[model samples]
Target: MDGFYAAYLTGRAGSGLLLFAIRGPTFIGVDGGGVKYDGQIEVVDVGLKCTIVYMIPAGTPNLITGASPPATDQRIPLEFILPKDFWNGQVVGITTPLGPVNARFQKLRDW
Candidate 1:
């Protein structure tokens, strides 16, 4: 699935809690999920907030897009993205995949 797609937190039954593909040397991972500030909900927190940003290449339709509320057992928030601003780094989605683990990223076009 390319262009505008959605990723749900299927489960925490493995190595890392969040799973995704990104366009960087990083773990294709976002920041906040690994640690928790005092008031900030840690990725392990029950109602954490996660955000994902993707860098889209040119020529993609509906550069900005959103997804339906995940139909899974998790309570992910409604996501928003602006493909134009995302030319260098597009904003993907945001949600608490698990406890305090809020995940977010920018999907870089693979082409």
Candidate 2:
């Protein structure tokens, strides 16, 4: 199986919405593997409360489920601060080699 996973943090800082996300490729290795190059946030639409990320290929064409080799040792990190009013229900969409995966923001607590 080939996919991706993400870890994110979201919060309200005054009138702004703070967001930080880290994403990477995932796979179940057997006799083959996958490679992920570098990834970047392609778009952030506050109006739609959605973000899109794209992961570039490292030319390896194989999936890596364990220790990443030097060529595929890359991860995607995104940070943003937007209007709080537009981020009530934000979703992050990531495009990987296999396909697309989504992560939703949930309020953890209030400060």
Candidate 3:
């Protein structure tokens, strides 16, 4: 199956974009500005949370997760990429530094 899906991380305190390509492991998901052209994202726990690691300026690796060595405020910008095999529908609650945000994952049968 040629999997294709999209997600948006809105309600950001400032302007930012969360974009994922239909194909490939590269994305620049922070709206209205200069973001890195390449990065990798891995979603875990059936979309419950994701550990986003990106290396910008060539050496610095930035990571975002619910809890870890890279703990971060939920208010910070984040993104997700579901695998093609993911089929469960769920509504995820993300607590940001601003407030609570909900993201829904519904399977789209068509393009």
Candidate 4:
């Protein structure tokens, strides 16, 4: 799926933009405008799956399960890709610059 992320720089902080194209293995996430486009990200376990809520610079994260998909490959219809394997009855936490977010398990008919 296509998602949009925007960051603004204030008096002290610099402006930044993150564009993520998550289709296959090679998850393309880029951040620029302030710091050099050379940085890293760390993923932590959140009961259900580990996720890198904070990614610095050109820090890139790959899809946990699938092989790196082609840059131009199309996403599977109605597929919801999660950071980690989640049990049907389990709850998971998602962390970001904003804060921790919670998610509940739900079954989908397809994908």
Candidate 5:
């Protein structure tokens, strides 16, 4: 499973939250469910108002060629999982560096 990430800053820049559009495997539990991705995280765009200079778990590189700073196809190794329990208001999904703590909602994909 794989997806692209976009870093979103609230009012300013530098640091903020991450918006991910992932198409991967889903995890279902008695408590709730989520989407689990394996291997690595790919960077598509930093966002319209932001820019991701670099990421983690190098060696591989970004598939997008001819980037301005030359984006790598590398993958950032982390415990990334998007929980399906948004109403509960629990700190779930995308834990590593930091979870999407400010995620207002999650839109599931057909994957």
Candidate 6:
């Protein structure tokens, strides 16, 4: 599939979110289970007052659905973090295949 997707982030630490855009082809499991996606996504972080591309490696599992992949892009809130530290900002961008998408972060309130 070729299109645009909006990705974002929320929470922090073990509760962090990795709202990704599912891309590529979809297929059923050998056991005729839920669908699965065979594509990758570009995880962009806007929590550092800047845009950073977080590499999800090449063969990261459980990126799609728990059992079957959705027909369209799904916003999955997975546990995400920046190394040993936590995400200090909000906002995230999601683009698949290729990107240079526009994204921004703003301070809502002081914590």
Task: Report the C-alpha lDDT of model 6 over 1-111, residue by residue, as the tens digit.
Answer: 222222232221111222223223221111112212232333346321212333333343343222232345443322222221122243344343322222222222222
Which tens-of-lDDT digit does each residue in 85-111 have in candidate 5?
A: 332334433323322333333333333
Query: Which portions of model 3 miss their true places by more than 4 Å?
Result: 6-39, 43-75, 79-87, 107-111
Clashes of each: 17, 6, 7, 2, 6, 4
What digit string (tens of lDDT, one per residue) describes model 1 on residues 45-79? 33323243333223322211222223332223332
List residue ranges in candidate 6 displaced over 4 A: 1-16, 19-50, 65-93, 98-111
Kindly provide the TM-score of model 4 when superposed on the true structure, using C-alpha atoms. Answer: 0.26
CA lDDT of each prediction against the hidden true structure: 0.28, 0.32, 0.37, 0.31, 0.31, 0.27
Shift in Å, residue 74, candidate 2:
1.4
1-111, model 3: which lDDT tens digit per residue? 223333333332322334334233333333233233344444456632333433223222222222222233223344454444543445445564334444443344433
Query: What is the C-alpha local distance difference test score of candidate 6?
Result: 0.27
What's the C-alpha lDDT at position 89 in model 4?
43
Query: Candidate 1, 98: how far from true, in Å?
Result: 25
User: Model 6: what TM-score?
Assistant: 0.20
**Predicted model with the maximum lDDT:** 3
Q: After superposition, how far is residue 18 of candidate 5 from its true place, in Å?
A: 1.4
The TM-scores, one per candidate, come to 0.22, 0.25, 0.34, 0.26, 0.26, 0.20
Instruction: Note the residue pairs that clash in candidate 2.
Output: 33-62, 33-63, 34-62, 34-63, 34-64, 35-62
- Predict model 4's lDDT versus the native: 0.31
Residues 2-86, model 4: lDDT tens digits:
2222322121122234444333232344444322222222233632222223222232223222224234422221112344434
| Residue 21 alpha-carbon offset, candidate 2, angstroms | 8.2
Q: Runs in model 5 with CA error above 4 Å?
A: 1-15, 24-75, 80-82, 86-89, 93-105, 108-111
Candidate 2: 10-residue stretch with minimal lDDT: 24-33
Angstrom error at residue 97, model 4: 1.1
Instruction: For candidate 1, give the lDDT of residue 59.
Output: 37
For residues 16-105, what per-residue lDDT tens digits would candidate 2 score against the true structure?
122333233211111112322233332345522223332424553323222233354344433333333323456655443333434354
